[model samples]
Target: MSGGRHSWITFVSKVIPSLSLSLFGQVCGISGCFNILVGCGVPMRSINSFALIGMALSTFFTTLRSFSTATLQLKASKAFFLGFTNSIVSAPMVFFDSTTVGRIFTHAYIYIYVYITHLHTPTHTHIYMYIYTHTHICIHIYIYMYMYVCVYIYIYIYIYMYTYIYIYICMYVYY
Candidate 1:
């Protein structure tokens, strides 16, 4: 949010999530390799895509924090700061050619957050506590619920749907 080259630096900061995607790929690849050893034939491409999506997800928080930190330092020129950083970085990957798992993971990140935030769950939440510690106990509980339902349950669904979609496309279309 600087005036000159600083603006460019601002843009560069947005790409931090993309860098994270690189790390995500490495981590997911290792995990996938382990799964393969355990007798799963998950497509390598899907694993790559999933890791990138994870990178995108990690990017969202990074972008927000960066913005907050920048705001604190009081840099001027806030013309169109990067938003929803994870979605932005991961978008091309998703549109171009994401594995089913990758797609699911990316989508789930958004959905999981939404679903978890729904109803402001764990109604026993104490706002005063968060005011002091800057953390919400209820929110964390909701997030864990999201992980259990959205992540754990849906991984296999992603795999199965991708497999099914691929088969259907191949059998029904010549392309």
Candidate 2:
């Protein structure tokens, strides 16, 4: 019963936020897919850019804040900054180049951490308590990322396809 209680507590405290973010991504992806199939202009590009910028800035500042506060000797701040910056810059490029299909899949990334953590168990010999301890923190890391990817992908695909069709139709009318 103690184990179950601990698991439930861990889940509520650690997994729920990540799951919620993942689920939000899933919904965004589905919305993108639907937009592609049936034209619905929803300011995907601007929203995406804003999301990217906001997420990058937040993560950057948060880490700097964490480093000064935490007593840990390890310096993971640089890597996190790089990753956060890279995601912000790269998401728009990838989605615009690929098919609208990519938008539908981007949200699945937020699930990676959660699902992976579930694969790990807290055992006496394994020392996975550390892993479980940081579980909730990971969600804060990826929330911006998942949304940025999906929105960028959706907007790019919609723009590319719609523009192409609009141009072709215009040419036919002119000719």
Candidate 3:
């Protein structure tokens, strides 16, 4: 009876935060994409100001969610490692034009940590865990690759449009 109760408590503590983080990631990803689209037509200065606020909020929520999950499920060292890994992995997104690979890599790093931690414990010793983790990683990689391709195409279009507009403005001003 006590064992079952403990299991239930563990499940609630772990699963709830995991689900929350997943939901937050989805929402932030969608919102960021929407903001990028809307900002294209607005003044760059105003859009950048608004985007700064939004990016701050997104970072705060992501950190909160990830920290909470790590603290809940992992040992102190592991939790720190997870947070550090995420920071390092996410850093490239600032310099890179596209985030699809960085995002997927972050997920893969977390999944790998999870797999390693699970293997260290006797209680979690199961073949299904291996299969489940690998399958999830594979699916995420495939999805992100497809999404990145589409994003690259959109970026190319945006660049071409901007170049065309710039050329037209230069000609009109000079003529």
Better of 1 and 3 by lDDT: 3
User: Which of candidates 2 and 3 is the stronger one according to lDDT?
Assistant: 3
lDDT of each: 0.40, 0.43, 0.50
TM-score of 3: 0.27
**Candidate 3 total steric clashes:** 0
Model 2: which residue pairs collide? none
lDDT of 2 by residue, 36-76 (tens): 32234334333344443543343334333323222121224
Error of 2 at 173 (Å): 12
Q: What is the C-alpha RMSD of each candidate to the true structure, in Å?
A: 21.2, 20.8, 17.8
Pairs with steric clashes in candidate 1: none
The runs of at least 3 residues in candidate 1 whose Cα sits more than 4 Å from the true structure, single-residue gaps closed, are 15-143, 150-153, 156-159, 162-175
* lDDT string, candidate 3, 1-175, tens digits: 3778898899899998878866865664454343344335544433345555664454444344434433344344346656765775666656556556557566765675566555654322332244344445554453344334334434443564455446434533543
The full ranking of all candidates by lDDT, starting with the best, is 3, 2, 1
What value of lDDT does candidate 3 attain over all alpha carbons? 0.50
lDDT of 2 at 32: 35
At residue 19, candidate 2 shows an lDDT of 83
Superposition TM-score, candidate 2 onto the true structure: 0.25
RMSD of 3: 17.8
Please give the lDDT score at residue 173 for candidate 1. Answer: 48
